[model samples]
Target: MAVRAVRGAVQVDRDDPDVIFDETCSLVLEVIRRNDLALDDIISIFFTMTPDLASGFPAAAARAVGLTDVPMLCATEIGVPNSMERVVRLLAHIQTDRPPAMVEHVYLRGAVKLRPDLVRERRPGTRGPGGSTATG
Candidate 1:
């Protein structure tokens, strides 16, 4: 057994809780499915939002999606000059046999433009943003 980590990032269009919740839920599900992860295998999930998105905790979206058993935390992303705005990033620590190099770090939506290398390098098996389609 080994420890693996995968990170995925996307931007929120609005600060409203409903929009934030829907987007975050969809994003989390995509990452998990892309990495072929089990909910129980997740050690924890950390979410960070840009300062502009301050309607509520993004972690709440995880709970709403029934990930209550998984430890979740929320924070604010550093405000760098000319950085993408209203972005929500997620870092998930998982227990698996795969190495970190094999893990896919996802960057989607507006964030995808921030890291084209990552987006382009992502495996075709990895799912993009959506319900359960594995097509990143």
Candidate 2:
């Protein structure tokens, strides 16, 4: 199997720990589901949150999603002027047979603006940007 890296990001409405955990878990599960990956296939995951997100570590959400044995790390994103706020990003390395182009990267909530070209069309039951109704 070839090793590949998948990227994902989620924007939270606030810096609440519960919001962070829910959004982070949603983002992680989307990446795994889209890429058809299992926990054993994951080599490691690195998470970085924007300076404004201080409620908790994104890695904690990964653990909540049952990634107990995966090597995970969390850090603060470099504060660039005018960058997005309350954003949590992840880089997950996994072993997969899919080609790089076939590997999916997920960007949810307002984070979709970070990489519009990579963003998947919102699913029927999925939340839209900023976690609002897609049609409204």
Candidate 3:
């Protein structure tokens, strides 16, 4: 009955709906799959995209991936100095019996560079720098 939070990010190919939707969908799916989360286990999701990306709502990507009833929100990322462009980020609150240490966060595509340590898909039973247990 523990609530765990999973974070993930992916880079959009462009401002086109097709690129944004497809990449966002793939990222959300991975975040769910990597954590072995049930649809109902999800509590809410927070999404943010760089100012340059505005072709679609990333929440729609959640719906496209079958998250019909989950509460989701989207916002614009703050423009920072020398920041990466076309990036979309997501924070998912999920319920699970697993401890927080067992959760695996995701960062894909260009976003992978943001957290290279967590981006690589390694085998299960690995221990990350945070001392958290990881799987994919």
Root-mean-square deviation of each candidate, in angstroms? 2.9, 2.8, 5.1
Please report how far candidate 3 places residue 103 from its true position, in Å.
Answer: 0.7
List the candidates' TM-scores in order.
0.85, 0.89, 0.86
Q: Candidate 3 — what's its lDDT?
A: 0.84
lDDT of 1 by residue, 1-136 (tens): 6777788888877898888888888778777766777788788999999988989787898888778899989999998988889888998888887777767677767777767766644346645532234554
For each candidate, what is the lDDT?
Answer: 0.79, 0.88, 0.84
lDDT over C-alpha atoms for residue 112 of model 1? 79
Residue pairs whose backbone atoms clash in candidate 1: none
lDDT of candidate 1 at residue 76, scale 0 to 100 = 91
Give the best candidate by lDDT.
Answer: 2
TM-score for candidate 3: 0.86
lDDT of 2 by residue, 1-136 (tens): 9999999899899999999999899988878887888889999999999999898888998998889999999999999999999999999999999999888888887898999998655557655445554452
The per-residue C-alpha lDDT of model 3 at residue 82 equals 89
The lowest-lDDT stretch of 10 consecutive residues in candidate 2 is 127-136
TM-score of candidate 1 relative to the true fold: 0.85
